[model samples]
Target: MRRNWAARLRHVTIDGLRAVVLENERLRVTVVPGKGGDVVEFLHKPTDTDFVWLSPQGLRDPRDHLQGAADDVAQFIDHYEGGWQEIFPSGGAPSEYRGARLAQHGEVSGLPWEYDVVVDSEQEVAVRLRVRTRRLPYRLEKTFRLRSGTAALEIEGRATNDADLPLHAMWGQHIVYGAPFLRPGARIRLPEGVQVIPHETAINPPARRVRAGGPWRWPLVPADGGGQSDLSVVQEPGSPSDIVYLTGFDEGWYEILTDVGMRVEWDATLLPYLWMWQELGASTGYPWWGRAYTVGLEPFSSMPTDGLAAAVANGTALVLEPHETKVLRLRAEVLA
Candidate 1:
């Protein structure tokens, strides 16, 4: 008899919440099925370092989850224990479309998604998670896979408009990086010819050093004191929050160089824009209280974080025809 040493899948509980974990020789991943199907942990075996950031709020048990609050943003932030989330139908602030109102960060991020183990083999293990929006007539399905002897995870997603009318929406991936893995000297590399502009709706003006609404080249940005801050390098967290939109990618790829490097490669045609969110202990509101420090390198199907309506008005929203489906693929790998 021979022993098999490939990837394996198992069910586990974290902080009293049901979760699924996948492990191999090189990596270990944990996904919470009930909590928006978020990937709560991504650990590199060699270094024993987890790349994913865990929110200070910690994991909230599904039993304790509150629903249907008057303030959607407050409700969303209350349960946001940082990790990777899939934003669909809409993004950013609350917006009205058709006759329905979409919540902040959309409906899926805080909703429970149905998950099933699709493959349980020695060579690879995969899981599929699906969810349907309450306000939008769309079904979202995502498949996550991890192969044996590799330090990478692949994600495939499909969004289908299940209604008779066309739908205008914003789709994005909210990936935030945090401490230990995110520190000074770490560098972020993106495709050349990229352009960026300061977010117009930034709440705190004093927290960020970059001038708002200014278009400039990638990586190198003009600082407050007329100096230049290299956007590629990770700096100490203490500054205020800043948001920016990135476009004009020569290629659709970005990498964060640290002790455990991470590279995200995607289809440029489907998600052509990138949203950079820097929260460096600047938020002094209810959720953050100026205690959170993280960076979000999000790839979006549209521009601006105002709302779906603004995206539609700017002609950046993706319009899906009746019964149409769009697919996207991306890979997150540990760089050698």
Candidate 2:
């Protein structure tokens, strides 16, 4: 029994899978190594709020999950439980890149990862998680660290190309917010001069608010109902499901302000785009069935979620030379 208090680390199991818990005075984070190293729980101790959303389907181990249907998207959606997922290689939809079949969000996010505790102390605790893509010739390693007396979680990652040839891929941090911290009247804050690009087509039809087609300024867009809709303010349930991309970042930081707030910062050079996905219960379509009420603030290296091939066609995909490595840094802090 290792009992200290300022910062601590523990290993446990969830649904017969390996899990790691890292905590301090202000936050508790639960990571399931077996499930794509997903950060399922990000709890703010002071507010008793969990910032990450939990989907209706909940977490299901892919190994034991029997696929009723065969489809490129079902592999990911069926097991998705609305936590933070690190999207790599391919994002959005399935695509074939250089003859290799890439599934939705790539192969790494659905596979198990190996973990090792690097630092264990009262002042700080850190663990490193690593995974290699089954199809792509790449390896990803990330370290999660928590310090005593701080409400911030720091993540440092590296993606390396293990093959002898150059590779093109898309990388993203899919972080979503919901429930206690994500209610009506909540506000989203971004740096000045940031612009929002609405999805090409309207989603959730009749309920959709922001008119399609906009390189609009932050927070406000021409509404479909003849007035301007405030994108900054979270609307009531049943609001349209919207997808927008934020660009022209003076810095790589965004804040969600409510009774309990959260600030997320990342390396802007590595991830130049931020994807805002709002599935606020208006999606009565396939998958959601109007059961979702969440917003995803994702920092991505590519745009529009059409998959890697589209990103390559648009010239937004990141290219890694043979044996090259890319480093990533990100942080999430609590604000009340």
Candidate 3:
């Protein structure tokens, strides 16, 4: 027998920013329009816990969103309010491709997105958010839907190129998880036969664990201390920050079981590659200052986070013909 649960959708303002709140028996999601239509809050009703990480800098008003930083990375960190963001056309550091300079994390994550309520009912709620890139001749649209009595979210997106020239791009979902729900003893499960590759640059401390540019099997990783650390289990806060990429997945899915048994499952078919970003309070830089202890399980269309130019050079970038459109489907489900 199925239980009837109260489901509703409402529009509200958070800190002077337009937001849409969708709630049901199992989940509550807050979508902010001004902040690149990012999902700032994803709360599981059963445990009253939020899976999304809120940056220490916190959310800022669109008016205060900074621009003209010395570089794109600086610009991105200045306005980033950790949660779930869509990176389009490029990822990683700023680079030039086809006469256009791409910024770190891309333009869509920082641009204002137009949203519309597609459906609002007692059984289900859906919304569509769309944005057009100012520097590129492309338009992106994403539709987020949630149904009653389920702890799952369905995301469908489409990217269309309007120009006559082909476009080389990288698309990724920056889904970050923070404390309380993400703690030590948490385990990650992925498809069989997956290979983990470490980043080339030694930007943070954890990079010292695996041989740079070397490929290792998933979960059991050789640490720099001459021992192995189960990469599947989450470490305590204040650990070193590391970045790695996962490939050779037999299937497109990964699951994370928290310390308390809360499970998060992600579909990887749409995105394919998983980028693991570990920021366990190791970043002592200007933005983090060693205060953030979060992990990003990002699914990307390409390898290497060195921006679009690198992706293209490595022949891993996705190319779209003139007037061509690509559609991607992703789902996130929680089990308590």
Candidate 4:
């Protein structure tokens, strides 16, 4: 138990940022000092279980690791790794170069992401995070600005092609939300897309649209929320592990409304594509058969590599010249 957990656990406070805990029934985030105060845990706890911490834990070994679920966030993108850009050219395979050498998502996001917080004239706290890699010529900067009444994330940087030859890549924001925020009665809101694969296998190549039913809707998982179900939660309630995608984001934004009315609106002008990830009991470690416990609302720059490759082959990958710099902006606000 915390010494004064009640008053202390309201909004996130920076007590030298040693080990601060912030709780709000549905969302509880703790910032711990690790590899430079960059490790934080965003947990969704209900009355049913404890120690069911989430957001993402750390790595077991840098060389060897597992796939998706909670592990996905850590291994794929650590807050510690690179700066300006998240680079993993040859996938998660180990390499020989230092700054250029990295795994899956990149080096910056895979490790503790260090940042400098600016407490400004109005008392708002802002953190600037950067991921850069030598082998890959580009940088990803995600700025998170938080005040008492508002929280905003701004990304306006460059993923420049440093290689003499053009480089292909995809940028994404994988917002993994945990329980009480995700429950049996909770629902996932999105535009419209019929097919989606389990988060476990999404990182792998299927070269297809995944197994699903219907044209506008499908079952999120099988009937019992166990085993595999091409289940679609377009409008109905969804399991914790339900996954969905939206293609009609020509509007470029969507809202994830919970049962209790806690709405998480995603603005994706810069990231037009959104990938919905719902994994119920699946995060319980291995053999994700019937476990439904969490969800991932991922906003990505491009489709899967296969899709991007298809675009290139068919002539549609986003192309930028040396002086061309495109700025992408997305905003999400929790209404009062």
Top candidate on TM-score is 2
| lDDT over C-alpha atoms for residue 265 of model 3 | 40
lDDT of 2 by residue, 151-194 (tens): 99999989999999999999999999989779998888877667
TM-score of 1: 0.89
lDDT of 4 by residue, 154-264 (tens): 233345544455555455554555444445434444444323433334444232243222333334454555543433332223333444444445455544445432333
Judged by whole-model lDDT over C-alpha atoms, candidate 3 comes out at 0.78
- Give the candidate number with the greatest lDDT: 2
lDDT of 1 by residue, 125-201 (tens): 99999999999899999999999999999999999999999999899998888876877667788765676665763
TM-score of model number 2: 0.92
For residue 319, give model 4's deviation from the true position in Å.
Answer: 4.3
Worst-scoring 10-residue span by lDDT in model 3:
202-211
Model 4: worst 10 consecutive residues (lDDT sum): 80-89
- The RMSD (Cα, Å) of candidate 3 is 4.9
**lDDT of every predicted structure (CA atoms):** 0.79, 0.85, 0.78, 0.41
- The list of candidate 2 runs beyond 4 A from truth reads 67-69, 201-228
- Which of the predicted structures, 1 or 4, would earn the higher TM-score when compared with the native? 1
Question: How well does candidate 3 match the true structure in TM-score terms?
Answer: 0.88
lDDT winner between 1 and 2, please give it: 2
**Pairs of residues at least 3 apart in sequence or in different chains that clash in candidate 3:** none
